[model samples]
Target chain A: MERLILRVTTKLLFAPIILFALYVQFHGDYGPGGGFQAGVIFAVAFILHAFCYGLDETKKAVPQKALTVAMVIGLLFYVGTGVATMLLGANLLGYDSIDPDSTHHAGQHYGILLVEWGVGMCVASTMMTIFYHFTGREPDINQEDW
Target chain B: MSAFEVELTPIVFLDLSLLTMLILVAFAMLRSRHLFAVVMLSGIYSLLSAAFFVSLDAVDVAFTEAAVGAGVSTVLMLAGMLLTARREKPKTPGRAPVALAVVFVTGAALAYATIDMPAFGDPDAPANSYVGQQYVDETPNDIAVPNIVTAVLASYRGFDTMGETMVIFTAGVAVMLLLGLGSARGGREVSDAEPEDGEAK
Candidate 1:
């Protein structure tokens, strides 16, 4: 009975968290919400699920190795955007110099989108990774500190 | 300027609420015995401060505070607590004297500074006449981003953003080194192996 109750409450908590994350992501351009907040909110839902259903299940849902890779990839994406701008004869992240057209509004949009995606991915993965570390069963591996 | 003149503005009420919430959260944080409760109250304080910043037209600061201060700091502190004690140590005589001296000096300095400062949101203040106007007027042409904060962070003040990113990266690296990547897994295994001798009681 307790397990059933936990499952139902977990579902209830998850629904609003997911909805709010999506709202934050889309409304970032016009309002207070943004990629970072959206990412954290999304991760919080999953972390709550891990608390309710146990860390093993959460690990299966989001493997730690994959999260590390996601973090690196997200940061690379952000830096790559800046590098691309430099390659196109612009100063670092100077969107206006991207194309022959003096006013590269489209380039600016694309650059911002890439950076925002990177920020979102890094934020989400790092949060989940922290949750995993805190909640997961420790392995038998010995370290210098121990 | 008539005697019967009345003014109604929601901003006045919101400012009062904001101030009240901030003070309440600050009090709760200081009074709480549980470290976790104090951290939660601090997060609430950060959110309230962000709201106040937004009301004062410092939207960029509000965004950063809401994200880094409230969200990220709370999560990191909670993670830190998992590796440490949940309750604060009992107060000591040594700490009381040092804390009181620090508070007295800081409060006096702050009071002195406030006397010379412009009123909140003063239109004629140097802050209003200086970079704020430039940001408002030239930002559209300079960065082409609709949100001035985003433009400033990503372009006008790109170096600072880069520094911030490096700081975050350093924090991640430091945590990984200090805790060691395998500590979490190891801790769990020991917990799992513990005997269930007290189950019946």
Candidate 2:
């Protein structure tokens, strides 16, 4: 009964934070918020949930291995955007040179979106990855405690 | 120039407010006893610094500050605290006094140097001439980004971003190695056990 109560309360507190993060992510272009702030807010929400519901439960939601993979994938996505621009006969990160047809305006939008998604992924996953490192069980500690 | 012609109303007030917040937060961070409180205060300090940057019209810098300084740095510091105790050790006077004195003198010297510097946001400053103008003007055509800072950072300064990414990757690797995470395969065992009787402080 106590565990159920804790779980319910944790979910209640975390829901608003998640919603705010999404708001920040989508509203970044026009306001003071951006991908990085949104990513941090998202990570903080997860970290709070982890603290309340135990690291094991948190891991079930976002596994450590999965987070590691996400981090790498995020970085690759960022770099790959640049590489794609290069392949399209543009200088490094030269979005204008990417699409020769439509004055490259569309390409710029596409490139920014891809890069922002990459940054958001990296920031969020890396934050969670660091949290996992600290909260994860330590074999040495168990031995010492026992 | 007539004294009446030089207006210093809102800008001066805003600058002073920013400076006050920065000083107060820095002092609070220094004097806080709880590690968590100190970490949170540091984040507040970073936010204040970001605001200052924005007021100075360095939007790109302000964005980076809000992101890396307030966001990533706070997370990293909190993670570090989790690996150790939350209480700060009492200060000792042995070598700390000398270190504090050195820091104070260096800070004073830097402040003195800035006293003769151009007022904030001076239009005729050298920074407004060489690269800043180019970045602001050509960003739309050169990089095709509406945000000049984004264009400057990702395209014009691509090499620096690559280096920064590598640094982050290196720090991640170092943490993993230090925590002995390289070869550990088994899942972490969840501990619901309460603190021991004597361990509770």
Candidate 3:
């Protein structure tokens, strides 16, 4: 865990991986990726960090509070969008009133982006939460076993 | 040309090649006695299937499989395998034939069912006959997102995707309940002296 190579490589790769995850998330409307893929990719970056650094250090960096909040907020954001549409006198998740204009795609492009964002946030953090739980009990792994 | 001769399209050749690779990886996974080798082979199988998904024009699914399947699940499996035995013990020899017979019959039944299903992209197919037609025709004017899959998943069927997100949320909650993370930040868990596995296990 204290090796120079892994630390350096992880440091180099972490930012780019996060950046790519964001690209996959936001660009989902026009391209192949969406929340699920982006979320996993995002979690993988931090998991890579955990691999290089200790889990305790990774937890300190991300903090348990932020992770749980993100996990909760993601679902809330998705449901909130539907509730907003309903409040606007449209059906649940209907795109028409979201934009309030006849043209401009009924705000669907933005709608997709927001929903995907919620999904990405939830997925990424939930995956991290799972990782934390499963590997929280992993201090027993010897340095050689790794 | 002989009547038996068949020329496959390039896409078909790619799909067949990927399927062959998938089968080989699956067999390798099954036959491998080492748990580590089996986990690694499963990752390879996932990557092969991701490629197969791309060949079928499902890039989103391919991305998901490559990330969650080949990447995340592989790491998770390795972590899980560390807690268990390193090698798989052989089962009783007598059950092998019966197991093989059951597998063969199940596989045959599944294949037979596929034969009665509609061919790829048949316009009159049951799937294409329903709301799929309306979505395909109106998606451009309705949602305007080029990715119809996203448009459908996030917009037209938003309720379903909300459920998916809720599923992920519930998974986090369940894991938290079982494993106990984040709830007791200040009250308990003050001891760093004890290793996690000793107490947890």
Candidate 4:
């Protein structure tokens, strides 16, 4: 747990993983990666931090309030985008009404980006929350028994 | 040789290789007594299956499988394992045969059902017709996305993905409700004195 290599590696890898997750989230229209994968990748960075530094430390970095907020806001954002389009006189989630500009294509682009961001946020937070729950538990026995 | 034949040969070979590795990993997973080994084998099986998806040109699916299957799920499984016993109980002989028979019958039935399906990469296949053709042709004009899959998933099938996002949200809420996520309000306290597993119920 006190190894310098793992500690340094996790610290170094965290930012890059988040950056890649963002890239995947935004670039889904052009590539193989998307929100779900990006979200998991983002969660992996946090999980790696937990593994190297311990759960309590990670929990301190990402508190309970923030985790819950992230999870809720992500879904809300996705649904909110859809509702905004509905308010603009299009069907629910129809991207055409999202932009005031004449071209619907640009609206679609922006709409997809927003939704993917929502997905990425939800997934990353959910994964991290699950990891927190699993690691948060106190083992019935000693750590070495496993 | 024709272009199709040249491409098909290597893909078929790769598929067979990946499938072989998949089977081997599944067997190893079944045979392993150590739970850690089983988890690792399952991760390997996911990687092999992801490779198979790649050979089929389902890059998005392969990306998901590699990330969620081999990456997140494996870590979650290990974390779950840490909360429980490391070694599985030996299967009783009485229950083993019935399980094997059930598995065998199910596998045989599924394999038989595959016979009615169209051949792989058949352009005229039902899956490649109608909706699939429409998505491919219409996505560029309608959504203007380079990746049709993204266009369809994010726009054409937006409602479905909204449902999926909700499902994930529900899962997070459920985990919080069950395990408390190290929170004290409307959840169990995380102090050392309380029984950890008891909080779940």
TM-score, per-candidate, Cα-based = 0.78, 0.77, 0.87, 0.90
Over A1-146, each residue of candidate 3 has an lDDT whose tens digit, in order, gives 46899999999999999999999999998899999999999999999999989888999999767998998889888888888889989998886777877575857877788889999999999999888878876446554675
What DockQ does every candidate get?
A: 0.28, 0.28, 0.57, 0.67
lDDT of 3 by residue, B149-195 (tens): 99889988899999999998999888878867445364366556756
The weakest ten consecutive residues by lDDT in model 2 chain B span B1-10
> Which 10 consecutive residues of model 1 chain B have the lowest summed lDDT?
B1-10
lDDT of 2 by residue, A67-107 (tens): 77777877787788788878888876666665657664666
TM-score of chain A of each: 0.80, 0.80, 0.90, 0.91
lDDT tens readout by residue for model 1, B16-71: 89999899889888878899998898899999999998887777578768876887
lDDT of 4 by residue, B19-84 (tens): 998988888888888999999888888999899999989999999999999999999999989888
Which ranges in model 1 have alpha carbons more than 4 Å from their true place?
A1-6, A12-23, A99-104, A137-146, B1-10, B57-72, B93-99, B181-201
Clashing pairs in 3: none
- Consecutive 10-residue window with the lowest summed lDDT within model 3 chain A: A137-146
Question: Which digits, one per residue and each the tens of the lDDT, describe model 2 over residues B39-155?
Answer: 999999989999998887777568668876887678778877766668787787456788899999999999999966665556656777677887888866765656665555555
**Which order, best to worst by TM-score?**
4, 3, 1, 2
| i-RMSD values for every candidate model | 4.5, 4.1, 3.2, 2.2
